[model samples]
Target chain A: MRAQSEAHAPSRMVSETDELCQKIRRRKPSIYSELLRENILEVLKCSFPRFGTALAPGKLDEIASHFLSRHGAKRPQFHHIATEIVEFAHRGHELSKPLICLLEYEWILLSTEIDSARIQAPQLSGNTNWDTSKISLNPTAEIVATPFDITLVDIPVELDGTEQNYVYAVYRTVKHTVVTRSLSYVDYCLIDLIRREGEVAFNALVSAPPVQLTTDAIRQWVIEQSQNGLVICGTEC
Target chain B: MKENALGIGLRSELLEALCIQPAREDIDFLEIAPENWMGIGGRKRDQLDILADKYPLIAHGLSLSIADTVPLNVGFIRDVCSFLNDYGISIYSDHLSMCRDSSGYLYDLLPVPRRKENIEYLTGRICQVQDIVGRQLVLENISYYHRYEDQMPEAEFLAAIAEQSGCGLLLDINNVYVNSRNHLEDAVAMVRCLPSNAIVYYHVAGHLELEDGSLLDTHGTKVGEEVVRLGHEVWGWHGPRPLLLERDNQVPSLDELIREVGDVQKSIAAGDRYACSI
Candidate 1:
């Protein structure tokens, strides 16, 4: 009896592994082939696994394709896919889902730093300290981890030199993280100011200085950040 | 359906565009997303405030989730009412689909079962929305696939919703075409069943076809011939409500979209007037 039970344990373990592998396989072509869909699913799975399961493969693919085609990803580059996914996810899939799904997805993806380098890089500035008391990440920012370095995965051979690879990855990482982090910080600051001083101007959030930055830089940063998720222009903020 | 007059979707992108080209005597009613300006403050609110004074504003919303089984988001409904009260937006509208679930939001407009229960449930929600907004809310037909087995025929379901809710219809010609091609339904028959008196507006847009022969409502391309024909047919019955072009992705130059809008206007005038005389 003891021998039979022990033998059954290995089979059960193998079956579990098989199920997980099948799940990943079924998901990869539809969800992970594009970086944005992958990231959105990753964040969703982490935050609300049950709800995430409800995301139809067809819907995710449609959204992924819509995003890919929108960003001018003519040939489906990983970076383009990732960028589009992040933007769509950040926008909270407005045309398709509830506002909260987006909020929850953004919260999960931005809060977790999959790449240790993203969390530790000193050259990239802004508040690195994950203040539990405050929301440190932007609602649109996402941290993704995959088997392939998404930045290096889809480039042409000539464009895939070591120096280029390193530079591209670094730039992509900084660009996504910085925009997300800065936007989050700005939103947080805006919320805080709204509480402290009622009826705060949108411009005030853009103009306010962080402990280590200038107001002009902050404004420019906010505008740059706005290009992705929020649109900012001429409004007195 | 008289299409030549330019009607701009009250998108945030167009706020600056509107300021640069404020409501001219020729420009038609400005279509505003009710959700965008409802209870929201700051620049968008201020811009809407200014535009409302000049242009005849129509409220469009994405978050109504009229087809959801869950109870209507009363707070959102109240906020929309308050916005309409302030702005005097009579022609309020939303998509004919659900976008929310128990888990908060899926963020994408989703397909709903076409069964009697769904139609009845949605009609109740629409009634509540109409009561709160203090006007008959126009429900736009959505483009979708993956039909449920229990669904009644599409035309019957829509007719039921309109009849029960007493809400007006915003018949999207492009959506009808997309659905017809995808699900192999008769687009004209679908239009025939819709309560003619309740249809107060028409929507026209472009679509992209997938490899599997499925159509997507990308709204990025120009209006196809079939949709244009259907739009003319709709105008024949309903005269013309404020027909608006919605272009979200693959956005062409304003000139191109404007030209398309012009074509719709021409078609509406030519077909409808000729039909009435006949």
Candidate 2:
């Protein structure tokens, strides 16, 4: 009797998940991942009282684990789960609000922990003090505020050969007063240096007595900054 | 009204092109969205300043929401009026729909209920807008889906609004085609009922048809045959109004859109001469 009850539980969960998927799909025909569908339904069930009655508890976690394992995601990241919940809520899903709110709180906690870890981690470069005042935010930078863990919500659990999630992000732009293809901070420093001590060639940036630098390193940095759209190649009039 | 003239929407995207194009020669009057440049400072304002100096421009907006029960957004009205005064933009227009509610804005041009109450409310709002702007404000009929049950027929509602507001009507022929297809109404009969004397302009654009046979007013493609015919008919009755070709998304090359506008002008001219004889 116990064995039989245990076996029947999963089928019931699958049925409940399928119903929720259909409801979401009816409104927005775009979302098509089985894992994302199950995760969203789980979030809905936990956050919404009506959904809880319809779907069994712990079923959502089971489905999420299955999805995470299949998609090569760390079980803890939960970025996919968070992202899905936030996106659905953004689209005006009634159940998405509470879930998104919970997810955001969770992300704030995670970001705090990550920042502490970063402080302990070995420095990437010897010069830790970098000027960022010259860097301006891109005009199109968009910041989406949601209640849930948007990143976890969107992580794909099951990948069929044919499906993908539509990831939305805040668009931002940085403007440079002078043109040089360099990382925003580096270009900012270079411009400041030039203002302070007239024009300098590629070698001057490396040979500046206060900061030890290499010609190859400066060139690479310039290339990287240019690629990032932080630096333009001409002086502003 | 000219045979080959095509007016491009003066969006920031085409500011560079506008700067380089020999002013007073390359294109006809540029149509600007008054809301974008109104009360805005810096680069966008500077760009408009240069363009307005050279080209004859008009203001087009999306947020009038003329039929809402809520009082008009006074700030928006003042800003638009200031813009018109600064730019000397005489032809100011918005859609004949309500976009906001008491709660908040919908960010889409939603359809207004075509009821007696709505008509009265909209007419009063239009009068207020015109009085504030100090110019004749033209309202364009919008494409709609899921119309209210208590609404009057579209033609009767539009004709009533025109008569009551004493404002010019911007007859959007493509929207009529979309609504006609969606609701299975006679587009020609609807066109005939419009107050011909009040029509200030005509608009033509593309629409997308969904799998369920419902039409979406996408404005992202070429104008259809039905819209062209409706445009010709409107020109036949109202004489030649400034016919603008509106393509917001999926816009083809300027050459292609200009060609389409050229065909429309030819048809309008032919229809105008024919109607004059009668």
lDDT top scorer = 2
Q: What TM-score, to 2 decimals, does candidate 1 have?
A: 0.56
DockQ-based class of model 1: incorrect
Q: Which stretches of candidate 1 lie over 4 Å from their true place?
A: A1-237, B1-6, B271-278
Shares of reference contacts reproduced by the candidates, in order, are 0.00, 0.00
Cand 1, B chain, TM = 0.89
In model 2, state the lDDT of residue A129: 27
Can you write out model 2's per-residue Cα lDDT over B1-278, one digit (the tens) per residue? 35335566655456766676667444577787664555444344556778888888868887676655555776778878887888888889888875544443323455666766555556666877887888888988888764555568888888998888788888888899999998999888898888888887778777787898877777777776656777777767667777787877766655565666666667656643211110
Residue A134 deviation, candidate 2, in Å?
A: 20
In model 2 chain B, which range of ten residues has the least summed lDDT?
Answer: B269-278
Give all TM-scores, in the order shown.
0.56, 0.56
Going through the candidates in order, their DockQ values are: 0.03, 0.03
Candidate 2: docking tier: incorrect
